[model samples]
Target: MSVRVFVVGIGSGDPGHLTGEAVAALNAVDVFLVADKRAATRDLVTLRAELCAAVITHDRYRFVEVPDPERGPDAERDSTAYAGAVRDWHTERARRHAEAVTREVGDDGTVGLLVWGDPSLYDSTLRVVETIGDLLGAEGVTLEVTVVPGISSVSLLAARHRVALNRVGRPVHITTGRRLVGEYDDALGDVVVMLDGDLACAGLVETHPDLEIFWGAQLGLYDEALVRGPLREVLPEIRRRRDAVRAARGWVMDTYLLRPGTGR
Candidate 1:
């Protein structure tokens, strides 16, 4: 019996952030798997509650929490030691989630995973599913998976900040903090950088201090904060506010859009 899994993105902690189609699909999911509930936890519960509040089929949903991959001190290192560690962690994470699906399905059953933002975006839930799918396929557990897209953090950020992602006749590059820090060979007209740890804009201005930045954190939440200016002035404030909030909340979710030189 083949296992049918639906990978659905629930947006950034808000049911209102979800699209109509996404909400419908979420309401239709039989079993829901939420990753990293024990660690970086409450938010997932809140997210689930939000989803339930939006949909009428609350009682039909069965939720499972899958442990997230370890993000430790060595997570950022490029050495063979650290690389191996990260790979092992991801593999283990995938294995556990796959095992859960296998055990739960036992034969033919449908399961759904709630991913933050769009699953096809920077989210790694799909990658985990891919790894686990291959593992299960080899073990004779046939798997079929479908992904339902939600409003991306970038799109939310744009709406919140009232900024266009790309200029009239230009292009925008959407990338991660690591890529922003490493090398930007292409000319950046307008860019929205996500998965950043607040140092992304700083890195850009450390070399050229003339860039403009529009930054925001907790976009759809009450604690949302936005700062826009030259990177030199804005970067420090972003770090300061981000650290304080992180310390207070135990977690933070943020995304920023930046442009070289000038942008409102």
Candidate 2:
């Protein structure tokens, strides 16, 4: 009677991005674990619920809303502090997840956590599940995890821009906004930056005035916006539009690709 948890990727907030495997996983689960963090993310929470309703046909499945942990201010500061804070947050979230599973789910029931992007990507749901298993193991609750991969924002970004992620014989470098600031190099080939809250693309444009940028916010959503051109030329518009969008929506999820040439 082991507990089985499926970490399912819902694909950048678009139901159209759902794969066959993701649909099957969604229907197979008896419980869906949803994390309601901030008011800014209410749209995402709604989208997850909408997806569940659209796919799951039976009334046997239920949803469990979990209050997300408070991440310290250190997460927005330095790298070391951010890592430590995230680890602490994940630990608390794992405890909450285990509690929810133990209380709401049957011994052999299948539970699911819908992640925004692929679990193997920048998402931390898989890591939290690992911690959940560790915390419950000593209490005689055995856990088994199954990963169902779905579309990633990187794939959506490239598809929306209609460009290849890499040039011939070159590799693509995927990094976060924090690391992109100091680690960007011309030798890294095409750079795809994600989870950037600080407009790191604008900073990159300042440093490398000739670099080309393909930037998109709220990818695959109804109000999705894209800006592309020489970074210096498009930086102002991107900043202005991004600010306006964030103000309107209360939050933003954006990613970009920094190419070396003019993209010609």
Candidate 3:
């Protein structure tokens, strides 16, 4: 019996965002493995369940929640320490994933891991899945990995803004808030930042006086919010709106496009 793991990107929130391929993958899965983070993020876990219920026509599938291991806070805030914490968390995650796959779906069944955005974009499921394969392998269980891409928050952000990500002849760069904190480079034609609830662009307000930002939160969902304009003028508004969203919903997923404001 072999296990085939499908890392399916379920998009930001909407079930309608599911591509035909993602739907097929959903139907193929015998069990859908989800990370049970905590009470604060329970809404996100429920959202994934609703998405699957809406799209998957079959009732043969089951969902198994894997309790995510708690990570210690890095008071040092050093990049090295932060990465080390993440690595240790992933190691435990791999062990739990291997157990869940075998216990619920068995070695002969297929399972799916629902990723919020495109697996390649900031999500760590693929990396953890790679380790899961190794763990399963050592157990004499054959494993196969498959990734189905879906609509990313960046795509949803562009659609909401009704704007393209890059200027003519300009390239687009995608990065995280942590990286954007200090790695805000000038060479990229356009910049898209994700996974940052805190305004990583706060510092750029003065650094790039001509900087412009297009930001959105809870994208693709009914309560979605959007803000744009000069970095200086919109920074406060973004902070207000972002904080409101978190206060109201207890969580927020946001993405933004930053440009040098050379034109338009």
Better of 1 and 3 by lDDT: 3
Query: Tens-digit lDDT track for model 2 on 1-264?
Result: 589888898887677888888888889999998997998978887898888888887878988889999986753578788888899999999999989988998889999999987888898898899999998897898988899898888888899999999999999999998888789899999999988878776667667877998999888888889998888888889988899889999998889999987546
For candidate 1, the 10 contiguous residues with the lowest summed lDDT are 35-44
User: What does candidate 3's lDDT look like per residue over 1-264, in tens digits?
Assistant: 798889999887588899999999999999888899889899888899899899889899988999999877654468898998999999999899889987887657998999987898888898899898888888788878889999999998999898999889989999878788688878977999986746778978777889989899998877899998999998889889889888989888899999888666
lDDT by residue (tens digit), candidate 1, 1-264: 688887877777677777777777777666677666454457657767666566636676677777766667653666687657767877888899987887665576778887777888887777778899999888988878888888787888888778898878998988877567675533766877887764666766767777778888877777878877788877778899898778877788888877777544
| Per-prediction backbone clash count | 0, 0, 0
Query: For model 3, what is the C-alpha lDDT against the true structure?
Result: 0.87
What local lDDT does model 3 show for residue 113? 92
lDDT of each candidate versus the true structure: 0.75, 0.87, 0.87
Ranking of all candidate structures by their TM-score, best first = 2, 3, 1
Candidate 1: misplaced stretches above 4 Å?
A: 37-40, 74-76, 79-86
What is every candidate's alpha-carbon RMSD to the true fold?
2.4, 1.4, 1.5
TM-score of 1: 0.89
**Which ranges in model 3 have alpha carbons more than 4 Å from their true place?**
74-76
Best-performing candidate as measured by TM-score = 2
